[model samples]
Target: MSRPRPRARLTVLAAALLVGCTGSQPLPSTSTPAPVAADAVQDTNPQPRERLRDGGLLRFPLAALPTQWNPRHPDADADARRVLDPLTPEHLALDAAGRATPNPDFVTDVAVSHEGHTVVTLTLNPEAVWGDAAPLTAEDWVATWRASTGQVEGVAPVGPLGWDRVTDVRAGASAYEVVVTYAGVDPDWAQPLVPGPLRASTVASADAFAWASHRDAHYAAPFLVAHVDQAQGLVTLERNPLWWGDRPKLDTIMFRTVQAEAVAAAFQHNELDVWETGTSVDRLQQSRAAADTTLRTAPGTHGRSLHVSRAGLLADAALRRAVLMAIDRAEVGASDLADLHEPPRTWSSNLLLPTQPGYVDQARATGLANDPVRAAEALDAAGWVEGPGSRSKDGQRLLLTFRTPIGDDLAQGEFEVLAGQLAAVGVRLRAVTGEADLTPVSVPVDAFPLARLPEDVASVPAAAELVARVASEVDPVRRADQASQLARLAWQEVVEIPLYQEPQFVAVRNGLANLGAPGYATTDWEDVGWTS
Candidate 1:
């Protein structure tokens, strides 16, 4: 018989956060290029090789390099985190199926014991050592845990989620075995172990958040930061001589900064070997123009959606449900990428990506079909009398203000169409551009109603808590169920309307091998090589 999954009962409302991006070579073009078919050619996943090459240089692109390479530091930006990922040894890896797989180079096994409290044991490979020839022991583990959990004062960790619950860290049978006891159940024992020993020394410093050095202070993987030129926005990673695993297939990997707007140009100019952010239609067109480029496409993890506010006349639960029913989610997503090619990017679920396992169609399950008739009926039953342009109740008009990220034309267009859909059902949506602020106080504006109260921030507590729970759950089956539950709640409660998830596209030179879709995971430095 299987043990029953431990359930944590808690309630908290918050917003979901997502982060990340993705690459190729081509001849320079001087004249205006004709538009190419988006899907002119199909590409396949690169197959593994029976035998790999020993040395080559792979040129990659980064939007920018973080001032510091520390992943655990609070000040480390997204760019820094991207460049720092592969250089830091990974203790655990999430496979394509999202199951945690132990990295054989670092950890031999990971086991959790729950006896009143949760205890996690990490059995490291005795042969594992840092790039500096330092044997990774219990000290590194202890320091990393302490710094992340705030057990040490003056150190600001990135976040105190799983680490905060850790009660003790001690050496097990040997220095290579780490025993960590938590004050409460921590189902996510693998996540915090990724950076492993790479963060220990920097995290021990009092000013860890702002800590910067002329060079990498430590390294754990097969690559070491050999050079960083901030002025030119370049970072070069050289093969670590002290690597204990198989020697890397590449001699060096270079990350150069290229603005998002300049990516297509960079690829067409043959300045970058891999265009890591080639998702948009224009980007695909540019890659298609490059004869030697191979595009790798996958279902992306990040999503584009709208967060509705509960201020003004939208405080009623029935109205919230009505707005969800009235708006055509498919149409909204369609309008988002209308200018692009056919077959919308990919519809999204509030919980898991479509590519993930155990995903259920909660939008359909919760009866959120884009039917305006049912929506009007829901509002009518809720005592919102129909009026010109919008419905009203108690002398208050059914007016909603929406805010999307600034400078996003696609999102703006999506809201514009949604506003019309809602207007047809007697709900007026004011699509605006700015940050979403929920504070009641109003800031002065240069328009009518110079000062109006801010929209009330709205969130589904059950949905948010379920997401948190899903992250911590260890069992794959149970985690999937929890994820489905979260999605169901979000759709049912109309927490937020998930529009679509962008299909990830990575353009790379045809010669490059063994690199998966960008952002899927760190590149296998030991396996990535050139065919030539």
Candidate 2:
């Protein structure tokens, strides 16, 4: 099961937070292009791969490089996923409608049997091979299965929920054919090779699987790792000669690690080719000011969220309820959404976004709303006497401290709004900024919030069980119903609190193709190039 990051500092009554954009063969256009359709799938000037320019350096910036190239490694993050996408073999490909299909480049065909237990048969593409010309076979799947399941000594994967339940991995009729069997019905049977399986040699040793990993994410995709400059925080990928799929459009894709504050300057100075404008009006304005640039906007489920400490000062449910009620979700959303030109959208369920079907907005539900009057009354009933400026209970002032990063002007600004909202309800909110032990987290790519619970916990909320039930249910209608049930339970119990849905705002140089705020659509790296 996935769990929240340990170190914590920081969201809302409902709880929410941040995510976001691009650039550079400058087009002949003299003005910043108008915003594309305000919908889920944002624009990247979508064009055919044959039409895009074949050779150009695509430079971008990364906050940091993945500690390990292995996607299964605990240290690997979304950065690692992005860096490896252009090079790694994908067994499963997601379509425009978010449907998972067997990738013809790796697995040409797939068959799943739900007889007694779940068994998935994958026919590997005969042309698929490793950088060494070694045909990808069942051995790779076996290695992946072993490494992913923490049962193997000295091997630990980040999120191995579905993989851990896999019982066996063996060859089918031929080495190119593989069969995977699970202990029971495997809900995510297609995930055995979702991000692509690892080579047996690369993962045979625990050392290479973890800390000893290099930045070279060598795989048989469209590109290969060219060089890694650790001190300079730069990783470059070049066209892979051994790749059997469509040739990557760019000759080289370079990613340099730069701090958040320096990204705008880097992009403006032409040191960087693309940058995600995020919620920063300054960055958006700068991108709009640049010639031949287009701002792509899309409704996204991803955003920032603050994890409340259940064991801390506000351990009691009453205190937590009061805090939630005291928060003005609209004000918080407005603060985050101001420059993006999006209206404040509030949510109480963690898993269900307003755009999705079966969604129920419980932000204004009875007893759980942004009502300062009700909040003060709840606090008063909880034995916290309201003083002139603050509330005190048992000689202790009712003060809650919120910490944010020193340089994070966005967080600091949001904190001020949140502080003002709470003060009206007589709750003292202390501000702490600097190396906070808080995690400002982003939402999952699939839009489904994973159930974050202790592995050995004796009990779990009904909502968590519903999440599992929904995952296990095979029927579409039944699964949808269970999902609705899960969403209701999640909000009713605050299992995974959600504040607002973040809209994707990407700044791309005009003529760039097949890369933008592609909500739910997998990145087509081979088609990403300049159309000019």
Candidate 3:
């Protein structure tokens, strides 16, 4: 099963082309050996390529083409953005744990002046320029800020971060220096600017945003679009001649749209250089079994939680609490694993992922784990009496309409197993297909500072108040304390039971380095090469 776009405190933050193949041929599938586990932590950091030669073709797969090449556009395609974001743009800094450091490739230095309104001065690399030879100067940054904020008519930002608090963005001492003056000291000011800048021309009007494409596009990164055969669902990128940085190792990189089910087969056949096997049990088996394939695993940064709708029978906190206690999150996660190498790890806190800092064991603190006796007590106290194969409160039957995305086999299995578990506890879980409620899932979070959190947790008022405290308080220890309090509040109310941080399994062919399971760190495109 493909992993859902993970819910991260920070937004989840992908290349190239050239002289490899003149024509595309349908890739033939081949078979290989049993998959096993890798020895190292799953990472996308540059690997040693000292024994490797330069210039080879790297092929991979994306699920689909992005509807729009402009990732900022409301209709931008997710798969396309996944590849385009890192390959064609420059950011002031790369996303990492703790404070994000300036990207020496794009930025020379960043300084802050707190004397008055929060003023930030960013110095751009003098040699950095767009593919079209236009200097990527402070003006481009200012244009991006203006276009993103909707200050430029017909343009709107991707989200409302701290940009509304901005007072001005002006050229500093030179064209390469951008001085931003905020209306207040906003801790999350760095959140919105990470996508780097839309070229000055692209941000000039609404029409220009739609002018970019996967086949022919302007780029500032180490790679540029070399070929795009949409009919064959293939995109190829080659080294960018205008790139000011070190030359990238591979001459070409290709992205072909491969269905989720077909990924394991494709990788086993040697059609792909790497596979991003996201929480798929079958894929895990296949990856482990593949001869010469190295498997990388890591603690996930995203949370897999049960999103309960307030309009359902679970509206009552007691009923929701009962359901949480009835289900064994460990079992549910293990079922998803189904004999995979790593055993499932139950999520303890809603606010922090297992790998992050400030994580507290709120699940234990709230005692929301599997306990049918406690579940029965909560149900009974809520006036739900046990009946034939189900429970009843007043005239209503304890039937909940559970939903998961269509075509998700793992979700289907999870729901089926959960239904049986709930049924054993006098509750009826009706597995139904419904549209995802994106409103509750898209809460913006900055990973490093933990500056902001979701406004509410459905009906939990205390959670909302606690999250507000987490957002405002400047002290890290105090923020962690407030976060723990809020997590405990959510758990007590059964706002959501985060099942497990889904493990990401990645398989890379031997000799390929600097590429694998991309985590928070931006891939250094130039460093991706092969070992001899």
| TM-score of each predicted structure versus truth | 0.78, 0.76, 0.80
Q: Whole-model lDDT for model 2 versus the true structure?
A: 0.64
Q: What is the lDDT of candidate 1?
A: 0.61
The per-residue C-alpha lDDT of model 3 at residue 291 equals: 80
Q: Compare the candidates by lDDT and give the number of the best one.
A: 3
Q: TM-score for model 2?
A: 0.76
Model 3 lDDT, full chain set: 0.65
Tell me the tens digit of each residue's lDDT in model 1 across 1-532: 1112111110000000000000001112332122211121223344454455667777877877777766666777877776776676566554332324456677665555645556767778777676656788887888877777766788867742456667788899998889988675454444455546544665666865455753444667778888888799998888877777767778888889988888788887778778755345576778878767877765454556666555545556678888878877677656655534554444445555454455566767777767899999999998889988789888988878776556766656766787788898898876556544111111121110101111221145545566555545544456557766766766676655666655557788877887746333434566677777
Instruction: Give lDDT tens digits, candidate 3, residues 114-167.
Output: 444456677777887777777888878788778877777787746425566677
**Candidate 1 stretches greater than 4 Å from native:** 1-44, 63-66, 159-161, 207-211, 214-217, 229-233, 258-261, 278-281, 338-349, 385-387, 393-396, 404-406, 434-479, 516-522
Q: Candidate 2, which ten residues in sequence have the lowest lDDT sum? A: 13-22
Clash pairs, model 1 backbone: 22-276, 22-277, 23-274, 23-275, 23-276, 23-507, 24-274, 24-275
Output the lDDT of residue 128, model 3.
79
Candidate 2: tens digits of C-alpha lDDT, residues 267-324: 7767876778876778888877776678887766565555565555566767877877
After the best TM-score superposition of candidate 3, give how far the Cα of residue 389 lies from its true spot, in angstroms.
2.5
Question: Candidate 1 or 2, higher TM-score?
Answer: 1
